[model samples]
Target: MASVGITPLSAIDWGAPWLEPWRVLGEPLAQRVTATAEPVHAVLQSAVGARLPVGFAPQSELPAGTAYEQHIWDTGRVPTRDNLHDFFNGLVWSQFPQTKRRLNQLQAQALATQGVRAARGPLRDALTVFDENGALLSAPAPLWHALRARDWQRLFVTLRPLWAQAHLILFGHALLEKLVYPRKPMVAHVLQAQNAINKIATWEGWLCAAMEADAWADKPFAPLPVLGVPGWWPANADPGFYADAQVFRPLRATQADARR
Candidate 1:
């Protein structure tokens, strides 16, 4: 039996808030591994039942009623590079398996009920896009305020310094299945630090578009289409679309320059 030899959370500097959830989940397992003779992977595997999907198996389809996190692990599809990202995702599964499961259930339900319509409605579109390559952004209050106000400058530049405080949680197990190729620093949703802000800002636009039809004024954290960002998807990535300097402002000085 192989074990990852779970390390102490204090000793590991994740450098990102998104990684915190994984650290918390893995901490106890690491302690158990240290205290007992069982392997680390074995210990984690023990917690997962046989009904889940494999993270490594690309052909692995979600069985009806299968738990989402379990399916991800069963498929061995976690886009972990044996690095911080990898470990963080593992920890996320350990801690929020139920939430993860719920998300998957929503996606599955949408697919079964809606099929692949050209326009899969607003909420359904959001759910499909997010489950495939969606990211959860736990941004600061100011950032959300800026987004809600449509103050692109404040959200993209003025308060960019606080971007470090933002946390990104990826929920794209199907997207991770394609990681067998050379993994780019930037994936479908986001691959870089700048992409985080850009993607979130763009997702805001989708929310706005959806609101035109749906009464989603209550669900702020609902999933969004990552590719909805201007200059992201091919059809919407035209220079003219990103030319709205107000929305996609150019980065000239440092984010901290405004404060100075």
Candidate 2:
């Protein structure tokens, strides 16, 4: 189910090492011994993943990568393992701060451009997702860097454009905290709706719905090459505990009724 088709997404085509990181970001594992996937295995290395107790290796394996990637992979891959709650907590601690730091860096570079200078493509894209009323629905990864530095020039440039295309959403209050936080310059933090496949999207929705999840969602959002290897989601594959169709469908209908 992992290796299905080739997607047109740049995340898939980006070529090695750098791309491997994003691929790692996008995959989900139920057990360490995945369904025989090389691309997936490539992303999960001994260096990065948590291993099964000698007895459990036959049942499952931990997805691996850099220290943090290892942690993220472990939580999802080893479902039967103990302490899901703590594992989930540790994963959050690892990801959000790094995301924020990167956003801050990009923001600084964008702002440094000043009145006469031009912002980079990635920098410009980050601010382009804001709302007409000055709210963020979702933003690109680089936004942290852009926000931390207050890239005024890029900010102004992205302002009007984001305002025009402002139908935004965010979801998963718990998981979303890492991607954004209080006092953060987030433009779109939450949204209430259903993507085509029916998922309670906050960040994952933004990724799969807006960012071509069919191709890019299972992979990391970085621009690196190789991406450690490649991994993907099957069209019929379930998202996770966060997205259960039966549960959300009823909830969505309730929201609709209330709106009416």
Report lDDT (Cα) of residue 93, candidate 1.
Answer: 50
List runs of model 2 lying over 4 Å from the truth: 1-66, 70-75, 78-167, 171-181, 184-260
Q: For residues 1-260, what per-residue lDDT tens digits would candidate 1 score against the true structure? A: 12265333234433333334344545666556546745434555565423334332212345666544445534544333323233334444544445445444554555566665667666665544544554556577787666544455565456757756775555454443333222212334421222345343454443324332133212234222333232224543333443455434343466336425
**Tens digits of per-residue lDDT for model 2 on 1-260?**
23344221122232222123223443342133234432323323332344322111211344342222223333333222222222222232222323322333333444445321344344334322211111123333333233333332232234424423323322222222222212212223232223232222244424323432132213212111110011211221222321332322222455447536
Candidate 1 segments exceeding 4 Å error:
1-17, 24-44, 47-91, 115-122, 132-141, 149-152, 160-260
> Which candidate has the top score in TM-score?
1
Clash total of candidate 1:
18
Q: All candidates' lDDT scores?
A: 0.44, 0.28
